[model samples]
Target chain A: MTASLIRILPDLARYAAKALTEKKLRSLLTIVGIAIGPMALTAILGVVQGYSNYVINQLEGLGQNLIILVPSANYDMSSSDIAFLRDLPGVKEVTPFYSLRAKAKQGVRDIDIAIYAVDLDVFFHALGKLRLEEGSLPPPGDTASAVIGHYIAFDETGTRYYRVGDVLTLTYYSFKRGRLIQHSISVIVAGVLAEFGNAFFVNPDVTVFLPLDAGPKLLGMKKWSGIIVVADSPAYVENLTKFLREVYGERANVISLIEISKVVASITAAMRFITIAAGSAAFAVAATGIAATMITSVMERTREIGVLKAIGFTDAEIVTSIILEAILMSLLGSAFGIAAGVAAAYALSTRGMVLQGMQVVIRAPPEITLPMIVKTIALTIVIGVLGSLLPAHRAARIPPAEALRYE
Target chain B: MTRDYRAVDGAESTLGQSPGQVPILELRDVHKVYKVGEVKVHALRGLSVRIMPGDFVAVMGPSGSGKSTFLNIAGLLDVPTRGKVFLLGRDVSRLNEVARARIRNRVIGFVFQQFNLIPRLTIYENIEMPLIPRGLPRRERKKLVLKALREAEGDTSWLPKKPLQLSGGQQQRVAIARAIVGRPRLILADEPTGALDRATAARIAALFIRLNREEKLTIVVVTHDPELAHCARKILMIRDGRIVGAEAPQPQRCIAYSRR
Candidate 1:
C-alpha cells in the first residue's frame, strides 16, 4: 500500500500544483491570510521566550542560594538586626548595603545616579564576583575612594564623564530638625567596573559603589537600605529565607531566587496564554478563508471533477487530490511565516525600545528552538486539513452525471 | 444484409463471437427517475440492451429523450433506479461506488460531448488522467499516452498546450485519447461530436471507426447527428428512455467511408 501511495503521490501533487497556479491570485491571497496567524505567533512567542531566558540567566548570575531581605515599610535594618541575620543557621555570609538616590557632577555636567555604600569583602562575597575593566577596587579603609559603574564612567552614547583618579562631586539631601539640608562632598574614582548587561530585576552596571563608612558621613543616615545573604548551599535558601522572614515579621520582605523564579514563571505562562489565544484566533480566520476558497474551487471545477470521475478516478483519489492542494498551500505559507517571524523577532531584539513616559529601555531578542518550529508546522497542517475536509468530501460526493451537465 | 467484419486475427474472435457468447454489456429492465423539487421525472423506463465486444453502435435521440441518461447508465457513471446491469457477465447494478469505479476504470472509457478535459492540465496530462487512478508507473504511463495520442491522430507537439488552448476538434481528439489510454474493453461516448462542425465531426467519427476496427474496442455513441450515427454499424433509436428501433446500414458503405 505504501509503495502504491508513493507512486501516485507525485501525480496528485503535480495536479494540485497545476490547479493552484491556474488561479494564482486566489491561491496567493489565501496563503498570505493563512501565514499571518503563524507569523504573529512565532514573533511574539520568540521574544517572550528570549526575555524569560534573559531574566533566568541574570538570576543565575546573582547566585541560586542568595536571599534578599528588604524593609517592607519605612523601617530600616539596624546593626543588631544585621548581627542577628549573620548568626542565623544556614547563613554563610550577610552583606548590608546603604543605597540612596543622588546626583553626581563632573566638569560642569550632572547626572542622577544611585549611590551604594558597601563593604568590599562582604559585598564581593554575597553578590558574586565583580570584574573591573580598569584600575582596581577601592583600597580597604579608604573612605574617600569610590568605584563607578560602566554607565557612570562612560554614558550610553560612549561619552566619558569620569575616569580613575578623577574627583566626582556628590550631593546628598537629608531632613534634619524638620528642614531639608543638602551635603556636598568629593570622592576619587578608584576603579571602573566592566559592563554588565541588563539583569533580572536590578542593573548593577548603572550604580555607583562607595566605602561602607561613607553612608553616615555623606547622607547623615545610620540605617542600612537592604541586606544580601548567601546561604550555605542552594538547598538551604528556603530555610534561610523562612528564618529571616520570621525574625523580621512584618518589618521586612524576604525573598529567595527560587520564589522569584516561580512568580516569573506564572507571569510568563499568562503572557503565553494571551499570545496563543490571539494567534489561534488568526488561525481560525485563516482556516475559514481556506474553506471558502476550497468550496469555491469545488463549485468552479464541477465539470472538471466530473471528467475526472468519468475517466475512472475513485472518490478517494478525488478527495486526496483536493486535500493535497490545501496541505501544500499551508506548508508553503508556514515556511514564509516562520522566516518573516524570525526576522521580525531579530529586528525587535537588536533595536531596543524605550518605555514611553519612563526611563526604562527594554531589549528582548527571540530565540527560535526546534520545538517551536515543530509546533508551528503542526498547527498549520492541522488547520489546513480541517479547513479542506468538508470541501474535499463535497467534491468527491458530486454525482458524475450531474456534474458533467454543470455549466 | 448482415455481414461480419470481424478481424481475421483470433483477437477479433474474442469479441463479436456467436450469439451464445457473453455480451460485454447487458441492461435488463433498467429504469431511472429524477426528483427535482416536489415533482418526479421518469428519465428511463424499462430499458434493456446488449452490446457485443468490438461492436460500433450509435444511439440517436432528440433532446430530453434520455439518450445521455442511457449512456451514463451503460458507462457505469450512474446506476439504474431499478433492474440489473451486467458488465462482463457480472451483475454490477448492486455494486458500491468503489467497486463500480474500479470496473469503470479497468473496463470502460467515456468521451463526453463537451470534451471534458481538465482546463488547467496540458494535453498530455489530460490524456494521462485514466492511468493515474491505475497507479501505472510514469514511464509506462508515458508510453500508453503517446500511443493513444497517435491513435487519436493528435499531434505530439500539442502535449504541452492546455486544453483551452486547443480548437474544439483538437480538444475532442484529446478527450478521445484520454478515454482510450487505459486500453479499456469498452468506450462510451455521449454526443462526442455535438460541439464540432460537420468536417471535424466526420473526422472524429472516422477516428472512432478506426479505433473500433484496429483496436477491437467496443464502442457505443449517443448523438443527434444522423451523419455521425451512420458511421456506426448499428443505430439504436431512443425515445422517452426506450430503445424504439435498431437498424444496420449497408455494411459496404460504412466500410468504404471508414477506409477514406
Candidate 2:
C-alpha cells in the first residue's frame, strides 16, 4: 500500500488540481481565507520582534558589562565611596557623575537635554557605543568644555543648529536659602556625538557631556548622584551587580544592562504568544471555510467519484485526493501571505516611538527571521490537514453503488 | 449443444462444468434483499446461473425485474443476502470490501448505461482509470490505454479532450476502453446503448461483438434491446429475481453484421 501510494501521488495531485481549477472563484476565496491567518501572525510578530531586537541591541551597545549604581532618597556617595567601588574585585573602572535636567538655548530655540558632568574620556569607554561625530571628547579637567548630543548639534529637522566651536547656554533651577533660583552658564561645545538610539538608562541623542570637575564648580554638586561601573567582561556583570547590591543595601539601586535586555526578550515572547493566539482565531475561521468548500466539492463530484470507484479506485485513494487538494491550497496561500506579511512589517516600522523627554532614532526596516517563516508555514499545514479530515472521511465512506446513482 | 449449456435453477445442469475446468462465473441460489426506508424489498429471489470462459451472454428483463441487482452482484459492486458467488473458481462472496474491490478491478470490468466518464479528466486519463488502482507504471498504462482504445474502436485523437466534448457513441467507446484497459477476463455492461440512437447503438453493439471475438473475453450485458440480445451466444430471460428461461441465438449473424 505504501509503494502504491507513492506511485499514485502524482496522479492524485493532478486530479486535485483539476478540481481546484474547476471552481476558480471558490478556490481563490478559500485560499484568501487561509492566507489571512499567516499574514496577521507574521506581520505583527515581525514588527514587535524587530523593534524589541533593536532596543536590546542598543542596550547591549550601551555596554553589556556596565552596572549603574543610583543613590536612593536621602542618600549620597562621596569620593571615598567611588574609590571603594573601584577597589572591588573584578571592577574595571568606576566613574561617579552628576546629571541635571537642563534646557539648552540656541538662537532662541530651547530644548530639554540631560547635562551629564562626568569624565568625558572614561564615560565614553564605559558607555561603549557613543562615538564622536564632529570633534574629540573634552580634555581632562577641562571644566569649561562641553560635548553636545546629535540632536543639539542638528535640530529635530536635521538643520545645523550648533557647531563644535559654538558656546551653549544651559539653564537649571536650584533651591538655595529657601528660594528657587534659575542658574545659567556657558560652555564651549568641544565635540558633537553621533546619533545613538534609545538606551535603557539614557538616550544619547539628546544629552550634553562635560568634564568630571565641572559638576562641583558649575552645578554645585557636592555628592555623586550616579556611578557607572564597568566590569572586566559581560561574564562578571551579574556578579558585580550582586556584590554591589549587598554593599549599597537599600541606599542604592544596582542595575545590569544584561538584565534589562533579558526582560525585553521575555516581554517580546509574551507579545508573540498573544499574536499567535489571535492568528489562530483567524486560522479557525479559515479552516471552516476550507471544510465547507471541500465538502461541497465532494458533494458536487459524487458522480465523478462513483465513476472512479467503478474503474477500481479504492476508498483510501479517494480520501487522499481530497486531502491533497487542501494541502495544495494552503501552499499557494502561504506563499502570498508571507510576502504580504513582510511588506506590512516594513511599513509599520517607520513610525518611531516617542516618549516624554527622549527621542528614539527614526525606525529602521523590520526584520523577518527564517524561523518566523517556518512557523507560519507549519501553522498553515496544520489547518489544512485539520480542515480536510471530515470531508476526506466522508468521501472514503461513500458506497460506489449509491454514488453512481447520484445526479 | 444449446440444451447442454442451458443452466436452469436447481436442476444441477452441468453447464460450463467440464472435467478439471471451472466456469468463469457461477452463482448458486443468490438472494438480494434491499431496504428502501423501512420497506423490505426483495429484489432478487434464489437465482442461479453459470457462464463458460468465452461466452457472450445477455440477460433481458423489464424494469424492476432484478436484472440491475443481478448485474451489481455479478460485478462485485454489491453483496448477496444468501448463497455464494464464484469468479474463476474463487469464492469472492466472503471477501472483504477491499478484497472485493481488488477483484472488481483486476478480474471484472463494467460499462454502465451512462458513459460515466469523469468530465473533468481527458479521455486518455479516463481510459487509464482502471489500471491506476493497480499502480501500474506510467509507460505500461499508456501502452494499454492506447491498445484498449483501439480495441474499443476509439480514435486516438480524442485522447486530449474531455468526455463531454465527444459524441455519445465516442463517449461510450471511451467508457469501453476504460473498462478493457485493465485486461479483465469478464466484462459486465449494463444498458451500454441505453442513451444512444439506434444507429449509434448498432455501431456500439458491433464494437462489442468485435471485442468479444478478438479478445476472447467473457461478456455479459443486461439490456432492454432485443437486437442486442439477439446477438448474444446465450440469452437468459430474467423476471421476479430468477432466470425464467434460457436459449441460444444464431451467433453467426452478429459476427457477419459487425463486418459491415
Among these predictions, the greatest lDDT belongs to 2
Q: What is the C-alpha RMSD of each candidate to the true structure, in Å?
A: 3.7, 3.4
For residues B1-260, write the lDDT of model 1, one tens digit per residue.
33333321111223346756888888888899999999988999988788887788888889988998898898888999998899989999989887888888889989988898888788998899989878988999999999999999999999999988899999999999999999999999988888997678878988998998998899999988777787887777788987766666554444226444
True contacts kept of 2: 0.53
Chain B TM-scores per candidate, in order, are: 0.90, 0.92
Model 1: interface root-mean-square deviation in Å? 1.3
- lDDT (tens digit, per residue) of candidate 2 on B90-146: 998888877887888898898988999988789998899888778878999999999
Model 1 lDDT tens row, A190-230? 98988876654345676778878777775556778788887
Chain A of candidate 2 gets a TM-score of 0.93
Worst 10 residues of 2 chain B by lDDT: B4-13
Candidate 1 docking quality: incorrect, acceptable, medium or high: medium
True contacts kept of each: 0.69, 0.53
Q: Which candidate is the best by DockQ?
A: 1
lDDT of each: 0.83, 0.85
- The candidate that wins on TM-score is 1
